[model samples]
Target: MTRKLTTLLLAATMLLGAVSASHAVDFKIKGVWNMNFEYGSGGNFTERGRSVNGNKAAHVTGWGRYGEDQFEAKSRVRLQLDAVASESLSGTVYFEIGGVTWGRSSKGGALGADGSNVVKIKHSYLDWVVPQTNVKVRMGIQRVFLPDFTTEASQAFDADVAGIVASAPINDNLSLSAFWVRPYNDNWAGDTQSPQNYLDNFDIFGLSAPVRLDGVNVTPWAMLGMFGSNTFRKGDDFYGKNSTGAGALGLAPAVYALKDSKVGRQLADAYSTVLWAGITGEVVKFDPFRVAASFNYGAVDTGVEALNRKGWYSALLAEYKLDWGTPGIYGWYSSGDDDNIKNGSERMPNVEANNESTNAMSSFGTLGTWTLGRDTLIGSTFAGTWGVGARVKDVSFFDKLKQTFHVNILGGTNSPSMAKYIKGAKGVDGHTSFTPDTGTGSADFNSANYYGLYLTSQDYAAEFGVTTTYQIYDNLRMLVEANYIALWLDQSRGVWGGYTATDGSRVGGNSTTDAWNVNVSFIYKF
Candidate 1:
């Protein structure tokens, strides 16, 4: 009787162990490393101010003036870990290291390679599905992007931020998603006398409905935000000095309006409101032929009439797939500021990953690839500009080799009269420089300039690019890219040429040379 009882106890213990093993969590890892070498020239377009001796000096461009080494090497690494218990629950963490430039001592790229504090947490989030329901929820710091079809990247908002997102399928053809994101909070250590956290939060709420049917897919989304007046105050580290936050959101016009209206001085002002709406869709019912389009509108109201902004943007794309490659044509247009700065700006506001970072509009450069690149010399956003381009993507003639070619023509939508309002403009040989505004205690208008080149109706540019890729192995690849741009600026007295020195002489020259860049990169994935 005792032996029989012991055998039963052993069987019960083994059964419990089997049940526990069934619930064990699985761990997975994935990562990528990229190394690159690049060279380029001619980003600066305007000439430096006239010399003291009254002789025209060599034109100074931003690249040359700032001592940007045209030729340099850089590398980046990213690692991601995921823990999964089942199809219903999971967690993820992503880390990034480097983009470290060779010979940069600060990032530990120097001789000893002892870079301090180089690792960054890019993403950390949890995902789970509700019991007995189709609802899915994600929380924590994660990537957030507004739906976009034409450009393949959100022009209004796309980045990583602390947020909560939930989604559910209502039917076979319809689904819904909603999110709440906090882009900034508590970064401001208020005045010594004021409370530490007074009016220092910027939050956004958004919703999107996706519809799918018969080779058709579309998403309509809307977002609303409550922006604290003091959210980007002067003393704060990241958002202060207009470095990030507002600047990263392409809100230069709003910043300019606030400073212009003098409303920013009043500490009593608590909050401003922002709203955006957009729709994007794609139709592949034609099979080999595809069409996609996107339209967006945004507005910001700060109570003061002179501190309001509203604008619209639209884009279209058409492509046909072939055995060897896909040929496509795309175009975009966005509203720009009128001649009156007092009426605020008409340019559409957006939230991009970084200042002047590339979007999918230019596929050969910047954000289009898994690895990042320098954006076009002209500008990165569709705001205040219009453009049309053609491309052949994924043209492959050999095994493990592919290539893409692109050509784009760009023009400005802003008024030429607005250029005259720019203050603290100065020219430095080999670069661009701005003089400080000592009188207003206000930020320099030049400092709020968002677009690298503030093109007006009189200015235009042409760009060409090509990218080649070769798979070196299952988890490794090599890439080579080349790009060129030609710019035409109106040098008339009514336009960019109107600037003059104290001596009433033209400050910069009338002509600018074209710019070009070449890049070689190796990428490994695991």
Candidate 2:
């Protein structure tokens, strides 16, 4: 009798353990892999090896120098894991590896393939619904993009940062969302006089309301930020030294002030305030025809007149869907500087991702080769410029093959005279005295090195591109893309021509050659 009882108890305990195990969280994994081959030329439009005042300036080259390599190859991989516990709770962690160039010894793309540290945590967040309520909250590091309908890319703010986002639905057609993000903190190690961690935090708060009606959707949003005095100080680990700090925000004017010893003393005890607002909407009342538009305005006040910045940006997109493809036209414009240095810049301020290869346009690079070509050569924000483009998207003639064609014309809105104030500005006598103390460095402000080509009223460019894709399998695809850009620069005294050599000579004569690139890619997802 005793032996039988003991056996029964053991069986009961085993069954209970099994039941608990079945109720535990479930894990799911998904990932993507991409490989690419590319060849291109003409990233630098400036004339190299010019002589200034009997002094021959060394031949300076820019990124993607005006030439070509046989061919370059690269690869990237991303994996995401999710832990789900019922419908009310879940957690996600996304990891990324590579985007490493082939044959790069540092990244372990060499023969041995033993890279030191190539893995990164792109995102890690937890989602949970309020107990007995419908409100949902996400907390952790994640992608944060502002509302944008026209280009599907926000011009003012779009990047990954640590924050808390909360959303609640008011009705079937309306919802509210809010977030608080901290982009920089504790980056400044206080000096001997100041205490550790003193006023070195940058924070942003934002809110948006999304509305949906019959065939109409719109969202209105606003954001406010507090920038500490020492948030971007020299020796800061978050952004590097003052000269190169805050580049992602396109805050060149402010950064220049912080870098200059004379100007830095004036803002020693001052902080800054930033504000932005925008509206994005789409009209799809007509089934096959749709229209989208967006307008945004932003401003930054650093308590100093020369460091303030304010401007606006607007864009429109219209498309018609056909049986075989979709055709669309798009345009955008943003305010630009007016050759004034003391009053600050009038161009729109924005936050861009540090990785230039990842900044792409939804209307342009329909495939993954957006960054592999010339799409963002004029800066991802499109500030200080205006453009018009047309595209035929997803044209299909075969079962699993599709193609797209694109053309765009771009022009600058900034005053041509502004060139004389930029860094490296040379006079007819080949003297650099024309350069201003506040906005001297081209790489410091909205220059070619930091952003893309900083165009003036006399500068323009035209772009043409083609993208073709073949679906090889349910989870794999191959793509080929080609892009070309024709550039024209005004070589007059008021434009780039003002930068003359010691003998009053302009290198490259009246014009420079164009730029082009071709890319091939294979992508797999599961």
Could you estimate the TM-score for every candidate?
0.85, 0.83
Expressed as tens digits, the lDDT of each residue in 1-526 for candidate 2 is: 2343345347546644654588777667788888888876554432211111111121123223222243668788777877788799998888777765678766557776666456677899999999988899999998887877776667787767899999999999999999999988887777864566777787989999999999999999999987777776664222222332455466545222233334433443356888899999999999699999999998877777656778888999899999999999998888887765556678877765322223123322112233333234556567788888888889998999999888888888877766654433432222232323221122222332244556777888887888889999989999888877777877675565534544554432223346567888888999
Regions more than 4 Å wrong, model 2:
1-23, 45-70, 235-241, 254-261, 264-269, 353-375, 426-449, 498-513
Runs with alpha carbons beyond 4 Å of true place in candidate 1: 1-23, 45-67, 235-244, 254-261, 264-269, 353-360, 364-368, 423-448, 498-506, 509-513
Error in Å for residue 233 of model 1: 1.2
Lowest summed-lDDT stretch of 10 residues in model 2?
A: 49-58
> Which candidate comes out best when scored by lDDT?
1
Candidate 1's C-alpha lDDT? 0.69
For model 2 the local lDDT of residue 81 reads: 71
**Local accuracy of candidate 1 as per-residue lDDT tens digits, 325-398:** 99999999989888775566798877763222235557432245456444535544577889999999899989
